[model samples]
Target: MTLEALERRRLGALIWREKRAEAPGKEPLLRAIAAFLRRHGLDMLEFPPALEALRARLQFVRRHEPDGGWPDWSESGILAGIEGILDGFLPERFSKNILKQIDFQAALKAQLTYDRRRRLDELAPEQLTLANGRSFRIDYSAENPVMAAKLQWFFGVRSHPALLHGQVPLTVQLLSPAGRPVQITTDLPGFWGGSYKLVRHELRGRYPKHDWPENP
Candidate 1:
């Protein structure tokens, strides 16, 4: 079934359960709802523990995040991000209570996941320029931070042996020639790092005709 249709059916089934518990044929209905929720991105384990309380907490995070602006993060954003990792992937061996008790900020920094879209501020940038004043910059902006480091060698072009290159988000920017006018940063993975990434992204994105360091 389509994703929307599936979620709707699951919601109805769960709501019905709220109205009546252990009713006739409730078991089959619960099973079906569980399967649907899982297919639609809910974790199998988290699905049961969530109940109405957890759903509200999770939904609060979704609704509270104001798109196009900084998230209402001074309080719960870090908590929510870290919680998702535990709720979505941690095995049963790690009790949910452990997740609840952990310091949100410290726990949030466990590692970056390449499988997810990274926060814009958490991004890193690499730029490459040619002798002719052309430039290219790339950013590996995935939410998964750990994967970015592991995949660093993925975008290197064999020919640009000494070229300056780096990641900003999902994009990879590279420069050519040994003495290009490109710039990189030592402030990577922090506030200064974000500024560095943005600078290159804007410079390259605005001037796309340059022979950006390419694989060939």
Candidate 2:
């Protein structure tokens, strides 16, 4: 039967029980209940619980699969995982109804596909090549994405590398040959013209073996 018809039948049964208990003055109560059900329908009662359950499931997946590996689009697969979870929680008929209401597997597949397309392997390169031909691996797990390269590697670089269609600037940790961070800046030009002279002097005394270029 249609969902609306089922809901109306259920409401009628409930109102009939209420009327039997308090027969004298329940005409107004029954009329009001019927009017309210007709006006609002059953969406307010149905959708919130279903949405809350879906949200909880999504959160569980995220928490358990920080690496986006669960639902493993490549292995056991997203569709299988979604179907398994839904089937485990609901009866076969109910699960089929929910699946018809929302294409959970397709939604998850779209998300996984988008993630794959923009995966660090595809879009955000792990190692970025500098002007000096030196390459540094970017660490995306940090609060701000960071790249640690030797100060000399950024000698002629006037700006930090921009990623994600030039929307994100990498937090550069300029290091010495010994891998000690000498300076950290998102603005390469500002550091080169500003605090770099003092940093250069400190590094010159600390590591005289390394080239501390005056112009750089």
Error of 1 at 15 (Å): 46
Question: Number of clashes in model 1?
Answer: 24
Worst 10-residue lDDT window for candidate 2 reads 1-10
TM-score of each: 0.18, 0.47
Best by lDDT: 2
lDDT of 1 by residue, 62-174 (tens): 34344534333322343344345333333233231432333333333334344322433222223344233444442212221111121123233222212112332222222
**Ten-residue region with minimum lDDT total, candidate 1:** 143-152
Residue range 28-115, candidate 2, lDDT tens digits: 3334333443555434224344433333334333443477653443222332343343332322232213323544443443554556
Clashes of each: 24, 0
> Model 1, residue 47: what's the lDDT?
28
Please give the distance, in angstroms, between residue 161's alpha carbon in candidate 1 and its true position after superposition. 24
Q: How much lDDT does candidate 2 score?
A: 0.56
